[model samples]
Target chain A: MLDAVILTGLTLGAIVLGLLFIMALLSPLEALTWWAGWTSHAPSPGKLSEEVREEIEAQADRRREVGARPRFYLVYLTAIGGVSAEELSYRERVFLETLTEALPEAVIISDVYPFSVTNNPLTGERMLGWLWRKIHEKRKTITGGILATFIFARNLFNVAVSADPRYGPINNAGVAREIAKSLYRHDYPLAGDIPVVIMGWSGGGQIAVGVAPFLCLGLDAPIYVVSIGGVLTDDPGIAFVEHLWHLQGDKDHFHLISDILFPGRWPFIKNSAWNRFKRAGKMTVITPGPMSHTGKGDYFDSNAILPNGQTFVERTVEIIRDAVRTIQPPPPTSIEEELEELLGRGA
Target chain B: MLNNSLRSLMAISPELQHALLVLFLAILSLLFGNSVVLFANRVSRSQFIRSLLAFAFLFLLTFLFWTLSVQALSAMVFGVHKPFVDVFIIVSQSFTPFILGFLILLPHLGHYLYALLRVWVVINLIIHVAHAYDFGSAQALVVSLLGWLLLELATSLSFLKLDAVKRWFLKIATGKAEYRDPNDLVMAYVRAQRALMLQAAQQQEGRDA
Candidate 1:
């Protein structure tokens, strides 16, 4: 009887021990996943799996059907004193990389600094860096908020010149001359028409828009320019902005915050004018959440129209492709048109 | 499959382990899941989640005291049943040596605040073992001997052993390797909290100029 009692005690003890072991392992403290990253997509997405594959395949087919396999050159522009946009997180990096794969070649990176074989004659350090530094420092010094009224007034004066039909394009002509001087050491050099994607972040955007005369002049063919987290002064004309797309994060108050604090063309910029104009085009503006300008990952995740977790990467590709396509006005075959056609009143 | 394994791993804990699990869950849920609690202070949701998890895991394993008064209660109030006695002995024995093991491993994980508790547990175990040896206690001898041997073996394998872990060590040494959030919620939380202040400072500078 004593032996039986001892055995029962040991068995109960072991059961309790097992229970304790299980409980201890479940401790709430260890669930943190810091050294982790976002996954692209699981191997399967369940019942609608075929649909997803079909859609992806159809998109690829469309790209091929359009003569030249369309290229998506996303030149990510960065802020003043910023590092290469390549530092984008694994998730954002994957998006850009994947987008590049679908195109003819991967995105050709052009840093606001001298990131390319694009040669310059004047300073020899590459005017990209020369122009980039001046603007960034200016933004750094410019006052934020209403206190920047003096700078704002100076912006108005500059805007007047750009806005003027008489001298604006003329000044652009002078800019073209300077660019020619810089490129050829005396005269404008010939540049073949390869599509250009000019990306800028913060003050880099200012330079990207301002220096349009340099890039657009003497171009042999239509070029596509894209801006992200940037500000544009005016309609850089139908030529530069015809196929232009601007991206900004919704929660990214960086651009918005900059506008609120130093609204006009302070830091030598007057991009607020273009904001309204571009809005008219109804282009995609992604919204992640209420904006903060912390980083590109935030910018990627931020969407005005897109829900928080949706892919801005794919949507960006489609917008660029649409912009570069043949421009045709929408046909008047709306619901109203259908009724009219039924009544034989179609225009 | 991985999710199932993690869930099962997390679920199979005793009361103390359960507490650590709760801390982990709370951290992830509050920071990543709800996010309401994170922004309450300078700390972010991620940081809050991490710190609480560390607190829960570290606290339960090292700090809770076993007293003479408790032993007296076990003997008198509940009639000091054999099963209860056995459970008390196993739980207490299991915890002490593991706590010592954690202390041995803590320094390698980097200088988080929880490392202090880890060292504390090790020192306590060493002292207990020595006391056990002086009194010729068999349980103390076994636990201390096993704990010390395991500690020595782990250290040697990590350091002296080359081919097996060289790649991992190199990555870690250069900070190329990522570690699960080692209670770094404090820094992340603090950084997020400071964003508004920087904005305000910029504004103030603008006004002053």
Candidate 2:
């Protein structure tokens, strides 16, 4: 009886430890599921909490009353969200707050998804939700653990297989369409002519730029993109953007992987398309020396004194505001003139 | 199959001898995974008669920066009474493990292979440093590690365009020959941001009034 009890205790302890390990590994996935559920329920700014929605509406009304032309609709897309606005990653939260303070009249919509796992309209679950449910529902049995492991392995395989010709741009475009529809439905009464600016940090930057062409077509509005250390691809959607301001830190080695993988940014390539974009005054790339991949470093730190008297965070905030101001529509050119210019240019 | 083809080519052509030599060097450089040996040779030959020379020269220049950086750090830390040429030769030979770098060309296993190769190279470097300087294993390890740290800093600085070559590139690109100040770019970004914020605030205040 004593031996049996000891064996049972040891087995139970091992099982508990194993479960804890799995949970720790899948914590991000679990958080993603919760965020998906939250976002699915509140698809748009209108569906946000009554108090938050009312506050935004009141602000828009005030702006309208003041006859502010070209009302700005700013959408802040989070990267694989589990954290709320209050609990946003330090840099992300700082960026959102800075934007809010800079563009007081702008309607800022946060927590917009760039992709979903299920085709379900009401509960558009993300990849995390499927993984979370697989583990949570059958967690008591050994098969449950096996199933979770299988799912994780399968996801890894899928990621490896789909690395090239990435589906992110397509999925992000879909999210952009949804956002445009939401903005149109919500702000039609308050402001009809809305200039949609989509801002994303890191992977979210890929989504933000991906949404540009879709947002432009869906809303018929001028689109601006602010990418912060974004792992961007050479997507044709960039052509639709009025202005794209890319902020990178010199220390952000991870973000530079895109350039290595895609040689479009290579300086030796004559008539590089991105260079043309820069020359045309459509794209601006800024490398803030002291910033890190996650906006850590002197640029994001409040107490860090830069060579200039200003703090790094203050400098970053200034850059963000400048990027926002560069979102004006391109100067009008006649169709004949455009045709002549195009014909005049040689490949 | 590659070895067989190379053997057949060697039998067929006497005129292709120099070309074959260049090809061998190219392959050697690739196996070494850096430009140190290739660059030293290319610099000795002034004018490039072949395209391979140009390629080797570029790689050599790139590799020289890293090797030179390591040598400087090693000299500083170890206080080794060795000529720069001897230091360079040992340091170049230390990259023997990187011949396995080609394993990183394989998909899915690249990350693992590259990581393993890095460890192997570091171990080789420690051993080489110990042998070359007649230092104890522990002392060699300390010297190698400090030198590596400096090399890492140099590599990162190169990537950040703080290095002389990259700074020159920046000057050429911008058409503004400015001082190589690290904070210059950061300050510009900050200035733009401040101006934008000020403008926004002024506009907001004006509307309120």
Q: Best candidate, DockQ-wise?
A: 2
Model 1 chain B TM at: 0.26
Candidate 2: clashing pairs of residues: A318-B193, A318-B194, A319-B193
Q: How far is candidate 2 from the true structure (C-alpha RMSD, Å)?
A: 19.3
Candidate 2 structure quality by residue, lDDT tens digits, B11-60: 85453454345434534545333222222122112221232344444446
Query: Which of the CAPRI classes, incorrect, acceptable, medium or high, describes model 1?
Result: incorrect
Lowest summed lDDT window (length 10), candidate 1 chain A: A28-37
lDDT values for all models: 0.37, 0.51
- For candidate 1, write residues A134-242 as lDDT tens digits: 4433544543222233223322233232223222332233232223223322111122233445555444454445445434433222334555555444434423443
DockQ of each: 0.01, 0.01
The fraction of reference A/B contacts recovered in model 2 reads 0.01
DockQ of prediction 1: 0.01
